[model samples]
Target chain A: MENQEEHQAEGVGRPGRPGRPGSNPEAVTARIRARFGDASVRDGNAVGCESVIAERDALLPFMTFLRDDPELTFDYLADVTAVDRLKLDEAVRFAVVYQLYSYKHNRRFSVSIPVPEADPRIQSVVSVWPGANWLEREVYDMYGIVFEGHPDLRRILMPDDFGSYPLRKDYPLHGKGERDNFVF
Target chain B: MGLEDQLQENVMTTKVDAMVGWARKNSLWPMPFGTACCAIELMATLASRFDLARFGAEAIRFSPRQSDLLVVSGRVSIKMMPVLKKIYDQMPEPKWVISMGACASSGGVFNTYTLVQGVDQYIPVDVYIPGCPPRPENVIQALMKIQEKVAQAKAN
Candidate 1:
């Protein structure tokens, strides 16, 4: 346990055998493209990776690929976050995010979406990752994005009676609660 | 854990009494349950400026099993209570908890069903640090108070 400085990423401190290695993300992407012939797979602009894509119809299948692939071993869903894409007049007003972690691979990946502002609806990934329950709720609570198949979706970070998502472009963070003075 | 054992060890039966008296007094591991902005201040307290390491409390375990103090640094929700309790249950006893910031101490500005008024309703709390999101200095003060409480315990 000494010389943690020499330890690999995530530090193999937990017991019961070391985890799996990362699958070729390109291969995974290839599977996504093969599965969904009609949809466009657009790469992500986020850090650590340049090739992460959003295949509109095959997102669930892509998720399944990440989770079920023995080589990929994305067994852990670390976090789910969402952002309002309002400032940019894009196709969707909201973007729901999913962070998938593979202890075996010692690498992580993220899946995201651009939900239409009008409907603000999309299929849920909770079935794919149970941890999505809270993250999805948070997304709903913050960005008003609804997961179509979520078991139970309600306001998470915000009060039940409160209106509007605080994280949205126009939503004033200070005005949501009475902590206006604390912002300083 | 037993009275006889307490007498044999010449220590308080409560894990609280023994640790504060003789061994590992300085190394108080904190379990931070951060949900909002207050978490930032708690981090600041642990960072270089305040250096919580000075108090031998720099090791904050995310897992409750190894943690001695649970620092509820921000907002808590009714839904999150079960997870919090589950984590608390895993922690070894004679443990301490610091309810940091107004949100954790008294639900801050979230006066609604979504946010719990305080962590005490479900879990035991030792110290309450108040501020909308308490400054890092306040967190240091709270740590000092916990240290005081630990130091004043009657030896078994």
Candidate 2:
């Protein structure tokens, strides 16, 4: 117990200790809205936890600000993924979701950006978080969402020659002959 | 007459085919291609309590070239089909394959896209042990069945 106390005092083991200096999710969302203006941040709400919807064009800059701002310091990109909503009658068919965590504040939040079906393109968040590389690739591989400006983006899970995105709402549950053709 | 008769019976003989069959049936080195839960059961069969060594098949060689029996004990996915076929092809002739589980035998409950419907679709299987994960004794029974097949095989 003494050794643990010494480590905590030095800030070596527990960076995400509750008393550390950082803003809560609500403060982070308000700051983003203030800096980027109302046009950039479409909506902000607390559904189970705080979630912010950002415009597709302002995504990269907004993410950069969130990481660089000392008060926010959302330094950890927990996950990068996408949801396919083909069944819903909405203008945008895909929503790219980013889960972020602040090590200093011990808080977590989500950011979602909707992308249209015809042009399912979104700016990659690899610049802010290097760990977004494979996560973004997985999203692309599963949902067929194109992440612009991403280096070395390709299929991360499925076979390179896999015909269609299997996670889409339109894809058949059992598959459409992809598993049978490869004999060798 | 015991000592006198035993001493006189010095030139006993047997058929060549029977001797060959006995030899082949006794020494079957198994290559365990274990990939899932069934692998644990296979290990139990090889352990001291179950004693697979008694059947002369405890020599678990990993290399396909050195092994005579291929015991595939898990679900085979579509991605793994080519690799499995290649290994089966590399094995020498007079080899036998045992598809040992519900998954390998008929794809079990994973009737989906990723897994192969059955291993027998790509490779010929001699014995199909039926269980989610067959017990160690059931594995031994399968071995005995294989031995019967070896004994009955015509001499080449």
Candidate 3:
């Protein structure tokens, strides 16, 4: 018990370890590039945070590597969400974002997968991180993006019978009469 | 020949309807279907600060069968409307509903798709207290109004 408390106290105030490779964004990006080739990873630092865009086909394997690798053990999947870029006139319609954190190194990294409007499907990372279950469901719920191998992918926030994804820019602000059609 | 004049000194004479109404109005048990910010105001009304017991409505019942009045004190979302309707249907007859804020009455400022426009679209409302979250004083006034309605209900 005393040893556990000392370790927790060390975690609370200690700075990033001097020799940890995953403590910086460049090392994370370089590690991904070395494994999956330069074409599979791209710098996506437009949002002022260290982020990388990964190809949809390579997502599951890349995520597994980020978790299982000794130097880059991104063990925590903080959140899974999506951004609909329809109004921005971007070529890709949606980008599914994953916020990953490594408890061992106390570092956070972001990964995004661009999905086209016509085929908005990606491999589920639930096998790599079980906590992505509900988060992936929420992304599917709001953006209408399909996670191919998710165990139970269904609407998490919206009603089960809800027709359209409200977060999409093409959807109206006041809704399309869903609120008025109740039996009671 | 008046019935009260013919009775003994301690005896009383009144119609059954009026007597029942008086009893119901004096001891109203409220079911607080609180879902949002307005619920805080409802709690304030029931707590010692405002003392809702003075009006004889302090007995808060969670079960629909035991309550005489239902106080819907927040925004009802599209997903939550069916559950709210089921609760309303379960309530015993001769019940009253108090729409206790702008949200419950008319969706307040939330004109979005998820939120229900008004709870009255699902259940019959007896009184609507119109404020973002009506003050505890306003809640007390609405309770008094419900009591007045109970007292004035005509016999079948």
Q: Global lDDT of each model? A: 0.71, 0.82, 0.86
List the candidate numbers ranked by lDDT, top first.
3, 2, 1
Residue-level lDDT of model 2, residues B1-156, one tens digit each, is 566467676765566777777898899989888988999999999999999999999999999988888999998877787878888888887889899999999989887667787899889999999998999999999999999888877667
Error of 1 at A79 (Å): 1.6
In terms of lDDT, the poorest run of 10 residues in model 1 chain A is A10-19
Q: What is the TM-score of chain A alone in each candidate?
A: 0.73, 0.83, 0.85
Question: Mind giving the per-residue lDDT tens digits that candidate 3 earns over A62-173?
Answer: 9999998755678999999999988886789899999988787576778989999899899999999999999999988888999999999999999999999899889998
Per-model TM-score versus the true fold: 0.48, 0.84, 0.91
Ranking by TM-score: 3, 2, 1
Off by over 4 Å in 1: A1-25, A55-58, A176-184, B1-156
Q: For model 1, what share of native contacts is present? A: 0.04
Q: Which candidate comes out best when scored by DockQ? A: 3
| Top candidate when judged by TM-score against the true structure | 3
* DockQ winner, 2 or 3: 3
**TM-score between candidate 3 and the true structure:** 0.91
Clashes of each: 2, 0, 0
